[model samples]
Target: MPLTADLTSADLNEIRQSALGAADPLGVAADLAHSAEAGRLADPQDAGLALSLAAEIAESRSKFDAAQRYADAAVTAYGDRDDSPAAAARALRARILYRSGRADEANALVEPLRPLLTRYPDAAAYVTAALAVGGRARDAERWLTEAVQAVVAERGVTEPADADDAGVLFFLLQQRHRLRHALGLQHDTHDNLAERLETRLANANSGAAAAPATDLVFWPRAEFDRLAERTDAYGATWDEHRASLEQELVRQTAAGRTGLALLPGSVDALTAQAGIGGDPVSPENRAGYARALATGTARIAWPPERNGACWCGSGLKYKKCCLPRSRG
Candidate 1:
């Protein structure tokens, strides 16, 4: 069967989670890998991710040959990228090789990845995990410490920008703590912080933490510009509608509902998409559409890269636009 072009990151995550819970997880992962290899996925990098995940699943099941093949393909799919994801795939490849008793090859494959340790916390974490997988417990501990120090020097672990950043820090700290405990080492300040972070994250996940102060909505440039240029027949301004959307987001968050991303539409777009007559766009029409879209399985995480375009349809960098507004 062909993979859907409209698959979002959320959909891929859901698929992976489902596979993990299935009776034959390796089968589900292998099937996804096959579909991804068919080149039907809209994002080419997703194919690499699918293969990498399948490789991990196979390795866990002790299907080393299949795992190695999937890992090799994942490396090829990434193809010389210097990003963390590529590094992760390479690290997984090495781990697979090590687990298959190709220790020399595994060491060689991972040796060059040491430089990545200073550059990317995420990549370094993966490399350390690979070392642990190869039973290099001492080496893994030292390298993990290096990774933690590098990240603290660059971007302190205490202040994370979003849940994803928090998750990375959480993993780094959790793994280090686990390693220390296993090696009969005493707990340190870092270990204490890790315990606190774990508690905080658990609370947040359980809906006991406070809601986010603000969230962003995506805006296609053309539509945003068109809406900005005029008011609707119902006497509501574009700015008002935008503010309404923000308020609605706040309301949804306060109600303990997550994943409330909004991709608002102009009346014309809405009417066309909904197959309705060209009735002038009303505030009620816009609100109803937004509420309906909020319940979707797909989500768009807020706070785009600081240097990237603002999610508010503004033509400025996010740091200069909505990000400051959200903070202050």
Candidate 2:
């Protein structure tokens, strides 16, 4: 079958999420590349986006060459049009290079985009992450500072702008915390990010905790204790997963989904993937196993109200779909 073109970004997101959740993502990667080719024959613009997504999927799985190949195809398809998308494709390539231990090449590909940090926070984050991985702390910090400015530059009252700012702030907080923790030096910048993170996380946790059992998957206090992660070491595993979970929620909300979906690449998913044979609800292997559960487990989030989005990722309200009365 020819691949589906004209897929909304939401559809692409579903494709990506399904692929991530699949036990063997290799099959999905192959299918994605094939679809990219078919999409190219049908529609170049859609093909470019599909290829870019394919590249990202491959990169997520550490298939660097596959990512590069798809990213190259995406860049070609996007040619001479909006450079932002193609440049993002290049950023993925640079990320692959950095992960593959080619720091110089990655830096070269990334440096020119410094001025764009205020617009493309992901690019800035990638540059900083590449530098950090390359043992270039000072360089990484430079980009981190730039990324923070990008977030601060975006303060606004508009909904779309606020949404964009939230996304950028999430990225910045994740990177900034890591950088600051490693440096062991408190800075004004860290203080700003920490404050934001604390407020956001507190809100998210409270909402999740106070939400009805029917709305969210709430474990009892004892159940939570049974499976909760604990370590004598100062582990920020929860912090890391929490940030990603929040980011995924934001994305799903943007797609107008009432049931926010978490990515499957969490530590919980990793532990589950490792074939560790232990009952998840049991207290045995409590820390590691629970950490895995916390990171990878799907937490169902009900829409704020019937007027809010549907759980199915469709950009519609609960009143329009998915309600018992509405479904009838």
Candidate 3:
């Protein structure tokens, strides 16, 4: 049969299943590209769909470069023809940039697209892209916060939610957890990003959307389990450390440190002690701290009363929300 004649919904479903089952996404992407170019698919949406599937599979496999190429192809093929597809492409591109350590570039690329995102604010792809850029830019904490609120708002209006779009929520939660950490806020690190992933999976199971049990045949279950364990360990350590510090502070206050006045120069001295003197804690520290923490052994200290606002300008009270082990 001619290639186009052979195309059917069953064939499309088969291709999707294969894209999800294939361990080698680059190979599947190549085949999809060939098929797409040969006009075996119905339209650009089909091509974009195939590319999107390939990109997701590649990402699950940690083949970021190949994922980027596939994402680029998806975007180009979709060509702003469909809002949803365009948003998905943009999200995929931002994700690839983030994975490649080009956070600044990713933020820049997404800034112009922010207005475009407003139209589809509730769409998972748009929300994911917005949060990705906001978190990566290190200056968009407010934007990230608002994005979370937006997700909650959207979920309130829609019952169950869309499972396919659950990735957006997962990404947003990860971004929120990261942002909180970057600003030195106390957060539950027990599950870290995995908590969000599990929540999304539960939502999917609840009929929010149709989410497959795994991204592809190789979903890195072992790696995820290992990471979850590490998350729990770190969370426990931080909690214990924080409790000890609080207890010490209380004892000191009882012994006569009650006034606890932080002088102007104290901020500077503390900054220097933290090895971040002269570096305004705003945009620069947010980005640097996140990177450092990812590699382990990073710490920051700021008097809650002295630091009126979060370094990221989130407008939240520093001590209550962002300061490390702070009681506000």
* TM per candidate: 0.54, 0.50, 0.41
Across 1-328, the per-residue lDDT of candidate 1 in tens digits comes to 2255544456567776766677887786677677678875657668778888888788878898999999999999999887888998999999998888898999998888876766666777678778888988788778767766666667743344333665555567777878876775644545544644564466568867433221233334456556444433211443434443444454456556675465544446555544555332333344355544455444445546789976666778967765554222
Compared with the true structure, model 2 gives a TM-score of: 0.50
The models' CA-based lDDT, in order, is: 0.65, 0.54, 0.50
Query: Candidate 2 residues 9-88, lDDT tens each?
Result: 56666776687777766666666667667663344456677787777788788788887788778767777663556566
Best by lDDT: 1
Local accuracy of candidate 3 as per-residue lDDT tens digits, 1-328: 1234534556656766766665655676666666766667755457776676667778768888877888778777877574765776676677777778877766665665554443454444444544544464344445555665566577663222223555455455555555565665443422233343554557546755422211111102232233334233222443343332333333335434443321111223324434734442332342343333333432222234645763223466755543544341
Clashing pairs in 1: none
Clashes of each: 0, 2, 3
User: What order do candidates take by TM-score, descending?
Assistant: 1, 2, 3
Q: On a 0 to 1 TM-score scale, where does candidate 3 land against the true structure?
A: 0.41
The RMSD (Cα, Å) of candidate 3 is 16.4
